[model samples]
Target: MTARSGWVKIVGLGPGADSLVTLEAQAVLAEATDVVGYIPYVARVADRPGLTKHASDNRVEIARSQHALSMAAEGKRVAVVSSGDPGVFAMASAVFEALEAGPDAWKDLHIEVIPGITASLAAAARAGAPLGHDFCTINLSDNLKPWSLIEKRLRLAVEADFAMAFYNPRSKSRPEGFARVLDLLRETCEPDRLMIFARAVSAPDETLSVVPLSDATPEMADMRTMVIVGSSLTRRIAGTSHVYTPRFVAE
Candidate 1:
């Protein structure tokens, strides 16, 4: 795409750290005429002379994506922003969903995905590789999907012994879902199974706690937290906060 071409760049800002913003994503933001995303995510982009910010509330992904695509079609260089990697439970999928259902001309537009660090990876790094072995990532919020599906996946992940990472584990409106998750784990996993709660990772106020499955509570997590549950092989270094799953699983 040329400098003046109308385009939409879906960019990931990484998890709460300016330093973690990828250089390519930063460059795209610098050239974007309009930046659109959820309220807090859009606020991450600093004010500039020729840039406009469009911030919307949560659960409006499709509408926000359509607005971005429409702006791009109107010759605006739009950046659709997300907190973590755009493809990881973020805005990239929403953009594609809009593109598929909208006008055919939108499919011809120059759309690019600019990836950044996802929260699961950021949290795993802070806790010393709780995701080192086979792993699965799940968005625990049932806003888009049913809680039954989440429960099914949780059970299968436990049965398969995959290290699991959870996003949006608990929120104000529907706090009970995560409690149900804990109950399911109690039925499926051992009491001493390792669980890591990494909150606000890479930010100044970040806190990480490594606990056992028996000790984990629903209240320990919120929208900003990334929770990781280790596989059967995952372990903590004695007397240290570091946790890791062995890469090699014995037959």
Candidate 2:
């Protein structure tokens, strides 16, 4: 796509720290005349000097997108920040949705997405290579999706023997959701399935642990946690912190 003059770059700030942001994403943030995002995401880049910031609540996605587009329309280099990879359940979708819903003038604004390490990838690496092979990611949040649909995807991932990474596993009001997901997985997966739980990945209070699928409980997971369920092939090497997915020819 041709880069438009007054463009908006939707940048991912990575999981939790400023050091985790990609070089390209950081450059965009530094050059941006305006930065718009959710309050926490905006705070991630708070140290940057002289950048106009627009912070909004989590529920105001459309308004955030519109503001970015409006700023770009006025010839500002805008960066809409998202925590983690923008293309993965972040602000990229909202930015495009706004473009499609707004005036054609908004279409002329150059839209670019700068990638960053998603929480799933960060958590997986920290907990060991639980996603070293083919894997699937699902969000357990039922706010934007139906519970039946989430259930179906969980079953599909289990039956396919894909390592699974779950985001937004549980929240205050949705306390029972992660436990129910575990119950469904237990029905289809072996008791020995390796699972890793990572909380506050890449942050000061980060915690990681590996356990068997049958042993994981809702108490072990929260909204800040990323759950990685290993496939049948996943194994941990003794005396090492690494868990690997084998990729060798069978004898």
Candidate 3:
């Protein structure tokens, strides 16, 4: 008989609603011998008789991923949960980072990445599908990359007239970066360009507002907020929150 070996399953818990968690993800969560993730994400999983939850602080993604990898290597079914889709600016990449740096034997381990509703998509739906045509997503956090690089990408995305969604747009420590981003947007786009700030989507405090670029303020967004800068063709339905980009490409 083949020896029982451990495995890792990366999962996204969705935004904030329990119903948002997929049935497949829930099954993996139920069968998990060890649940590992950041404190808030781990808290979402209910206490169960056979499951052990391991919660750690934010910003220590590599170490946390290694912990989950180690647990799974010991024959435990481990689920590393992230708030949104793991592959989208979350723990999935961190796990792969750890795996690549670990021994070749680790490569033989079974690993599965289960997708879930990401914040950007949820926020986009709350608004009117500004991403209706072509779009790109950016992670504005300078933690992993430099600010100059982010600005360059932002400028290029605008130059190409792509509808854009941003993750980690701002935090308490990096407040000024987002302000600079706004300045960049104002440089290449008109004052009336549509911008949407969707905060805490699906949660009780959820607030989504569509405004013109001139009216956008730095304080309007935070780490929990998803910012979408509309293309030249994006517009709103006069008096409603509805905003969308036309399907036809513009010259």
TM-score for predicted model 1 compared with the true structure: 0.97
Name the regions of candidate 1 deviating beyond 4 angstroms: 1-4
Query: Which model is ahead, 1 or 2, in terms of TM-score?
Result: 1
Q: Which of the two, 2 or 3, has more TM-score?
A: 3
lDDT score at residue 222, model 1, on the 0-100 scale: 95
Candidate 1 clash pair list: none
Cα lDDT of all candidates, in order?
A: 0.94, 0.87, 0.92
**Would you estimate the TM-scores of all the predictions?**
0.97, 0.93, 0.97
Better of 2 and 3 by lDDT: 3
Q: What tens-digit string does per-residue lDDT give for candidate 1 at 53-97?
A: 999999999999999998888889999999989999999999999
Clashing pairs in 3: 6-75
TM-score, candidate 2, is 0.93
